[model samples]
Target chain A: MDSRVWDNRAWLFVVPVMAFVLFSSLIPMMTVVNYSFQDSMGQNSFFWNGPGWFQNLLDPTTAVGARFQGALLRNFAFSFTVLAIEIPLGIAVALCIPKSGWRVGAVLVAIALPLLIPYNVVGTIWQLFSRTDIGLLGVALGRSGVPFNVTQNAGSAWAVIVLMDVWHWTSMVALLCYAGLKAIPDAYYQAARIDGANRWSVFRNIELPKLRKVLVIAMLLRFMGSFMIYTEPFTVTGGGPGEDTSFLSIDLVKMALGQVDLGNAAAYSLVYNLITLTVCWMFFTYTTHADSKDVA
Target chain B: MLDRIGLKRGDEVHIADASLELHAGSMNVLLGPTLSGKTTLMRLMAGLDRPTSGRLVEDGRDVTGLGVKHRSVAMVYQQFVNYPTLSVYENIASPLRVQGLPKAEIESRVARAAKLMRLEPMLKRTPAQLSGGQQQRTALARALVKQAKLVLLDEPLANLDYKLREELREELPRIFAETGAILVYATTEPAEALLLRGSTATLREGRITQVGPSAALYREPGNLDAARVFSDPPLNELALTVSNGVAALADGSRLPGDGALGALPDGAATLGFRADAAAAAVAVGGDGRDPSHPAFPGTVAVTEISGSESFVHIATDAGLGTLVCLVEGVHAFEPGDRAEARLDLARAFAFGADGRRIAARPAAAPRREPVPA
Candidate 1:
């Protein structure tokens, strides 16, 4: 017989959160779903279109489809670029931070300052900082005659957006990595040292393995955050320079709010949500299952 | 051999006057409770931590500056710290692979170590996937595969369940017997030190008070601190004033002072003995009581029955603290029962006011009653 006592009343504590989720997320999500299947004009009039917008969005030949495809590729490139730079840089920064002393607190707070800044404020700071006429970096580069202009050159816009995003978010990854590194008991390192492991071997065998679960969290957060990046780029570049920096969220906002294309935006958003969910699911499944399979 | 004398950190001293020499092909157990600087001393030996004072000399060379990676040392921790992501084979092979060994050599060593640890069948498994014992075995196998000259175990089996602890405790000495390494094992339990049968060092408050053969240390703890560290339920202590060949209890009760007790100078002293050295019997007849042995009247406060032995804790009428008597069988003495505890004064040790052992104990005599297994 099972020895576990079944107590369902404990779930009463979760009812508030469940009700909040229903009101905050599920109802809106259902509304988006409802919008995806119907065509709407002005004056709240709606007509059933039977997935017309979805078909156009999914087909590469259609205008909406081609736009979605471009934005998706841009999102992928941006997410991958930032993650590749941020993860290693974060780890290196975390390693460089002193393990103990008066400086650790100061360094950690400084590292976390960028993370604490509001996204739009960060965007505005970068926008002003990168302006050719008055910005610190922009004037310096302009004086060097590199022909830097986020408005006129696609490369400049892309570089600035990537750099700005990196500056704002790499600390977050570093903080997570630092916390993960700190959580590892000193015994593992001591044992590794006694085992004659060199510097690289210690990192490869002990530190890296211990940091796996934390890295998973960092990767997922970075991936999803970068994939749907809107505020900073929108504030600085506004998806300018011939759509060089327009990510999924930026393009979706332009389509829904600027162009008033609700049908296409709703369909676009559902598929966008689906892709993010799918990637996260794959990551979650692969990592969590791989370790549990090889039991003795 | 390592010497750690007066280890100072800032203005405070840790491990003062704690010097020990660990010989090859022998197990040296550092017996101490928590925060006794056991780990710090082991770290100094392993070259993981440098002693603020004294030298850790190996083969007549000072290597205090060299880091642990440069030394031939292996340490197993209380928490089984096997690489969570690596397979058992890879985990065992870790140290070997780090030494730049060839593929064939690493393979052979890992195979042998795996078989010895009985982890051969689980070579494909990760530490997270193994049982606690198997995980610890993986850690031990990692230490074993390196063939290091010095092996330090910081309470390796402390985290295991009681049964697993027992099993590994029996298997550990056998595992180390074949190796000629200088093995240093740290534990808080006196029973474990005795069972391991090594030169045991008793540490208290960061200082080692005694170091001798395991049984010798138990029979003759040179100081009160060492004896207290070596006891499980703790060595019983009673203040005594010795004069005219008699020791006076606080309540004006008298105990016959003879042998080791009589040898002490006529002055204030304390008597210390193991639980087994004292016996609690019915106050009326006092069966099996020696005529010369004095009985201290006490009321039974509590009784604990292990499988083979029972410990009767009696609150003595005398002002001295409660005395615990080890009985061989389950007497089931109830609380509030009037009793008299007959202490074996012949075997008891007397300590001076400075907490130094004042009595010169007799040479080794076979124990009359074995401690509870």
Candidate 2:
């Protein structure tokens, strides 16, 4: 056996990337951790608070605590609600896309256009579109004699935000599902037909089961994106109407930049990060476990 | 017991017509070459696709308008049909579940099918856990669970190895006998066609060329094409000229026969003979110099020896191309050797320019079935 031929040179190539990631991610994360546990009052003068900020954030009475808790609940509800609607809608659209030719290409392009738009730009665009004065949507609603204010009403604001997010991100789920549908071998459908499966049965037994792997991926990605929704809602509503439309990220920004409470903001940010990571972890574990059982 | 069924497809095509009748408790094999409409015919029978102008009838009832689920036909595709995400048990039980069968019934059927396929130990294992042949058996078990009256096997064993193919061949007939369901299987291999040896038919260019017993079709083909297709080493065809009560081979040697050439053509005619037919009365002489001998001198062009017999390709002196003959054992004959071949006049067939038999000679034995309707 020629053990000397084994390559150790790959690590040398990976050294720069490892160093870059450490500087870009690990270093900033360390600074956030340091600020989380300490209170720096002025001019970089720091004192150890020993979990004082954590205690305050968990109290549910402080401004940071109230804003964080409210936003967390709202975000969780929004993500799940959006997920329930978008996943099925995406799969339906994917199923309708033809398998080949210019028509499929046109559909792919149309579905992908919204996903290509920058997130902040999506928020700004939706903000303009929801304006009561000049926006077409607002004018159309006005003509219908309905109260069409998105900026002043928290419910209307949340509705617009959810709709906008669905318009922008549902295509991603559809595209993933479309790719999955395309990869399904035609033999399965033929067999299903021969086994005397009707359309609904075919969809339920064959298509859905086969799409399980892709559906999991779409679900996880959509969940994480919706849970961490910040830029679009922030630009569209600016967290107005007494913190009703405000999410965790919006509250985090208010703590760090508005009140200049870096320690509390860092603690809030850490807690926010933990929540997103935990939810995502739970989703991944649950889906993978269920899939394994199906496999078994 | 699977009740008898019937189907009809009157789809017009540029080449040939298509119509098939499948009976319950009988296995029907669809044999054809490429582009012979075998798959299309199978799909129509399975109710996967509709015909332009045809109806499928079962037990004297019109079932053409019914969807696949309404019809009770199960199919095993050439590609394995196990649900990739589901375990072996789940895959087999799916058809039963679709029928809204009781869970106990589903369990019993799945267990029986799995046991028959030798997959009981791997019930909880997914499709990826099994090999290709095992996956195929899982698919077969799934179809069995469906309990459909007609089992359509579309080239089921096409992708298997030789040994697996033989094993499955023996197993498939057993299953068919046990279920007593009509089996309509498609295959391209002539050897596999012999395996069923049932009511077999050859579909060519979208039409049925011949339908009869496998052995009968093999022994006496109605036309030259059928004979050429049916034989193992194909029947040899050569051009000949018959003049004034004497039929001469293309090599200019007269075929020895005491028969009149009635209404014979003046110019060219096609002569046919199977390779295994024998020739006698060879005279030892220079290139066909012995006029009294019945043999014609030809050069042995090529020889391919296979264990018990050999295929000899010979070119005669009359400038005809290679003629193939099956000779017994190995013969030490090189290319360009002066060889004398005696004609087997009794086995020879003569056809006119229109590709129809011209000779009124009686066959070796009585042919069955009113000249093949």
* Model 2 stretches with alpha carbons more than 4 Å out: A37-62, A98-103, A142-148, A274-296, B1-15, B33-35, B54-66, B82-135, B145-147, B159-163, B215-373
Judging by lDDT against the true structure, name the best candidate: 1
Model 2, range A105-166, lDDT digits (tens) per residue? 89899999999999999998888888888887777887888887887787778888889999
Which pairs clash inside model 2?
Answer: none
Evaluated at residue A245, the lDDT of candidate 1 is 82
lDDT of 2 by residue, B1-373 (tens): 1112223445446224455666677777777776676777776776776655555678888776567767888888787777766789988988887788999988998898998888899999888778788889998899887778888888899888879889998888677657878888888777787777666677766666666776666554555555555555556676767777566766677654525234566667776666665331222654633332235567887877886887777776667665677778877667777775655645656667766567754455455543211
Candidate 2 chain B has its poorest 10 consecutive residues by lDDT at B1-10
Alpha carbon deviation, residue A28, candidate 1 (Å) = 3.6
CAPRI-style docking class of model 1 based on DockQ:
acceptable
Chain A TM per prediction: 0.91, 0.92
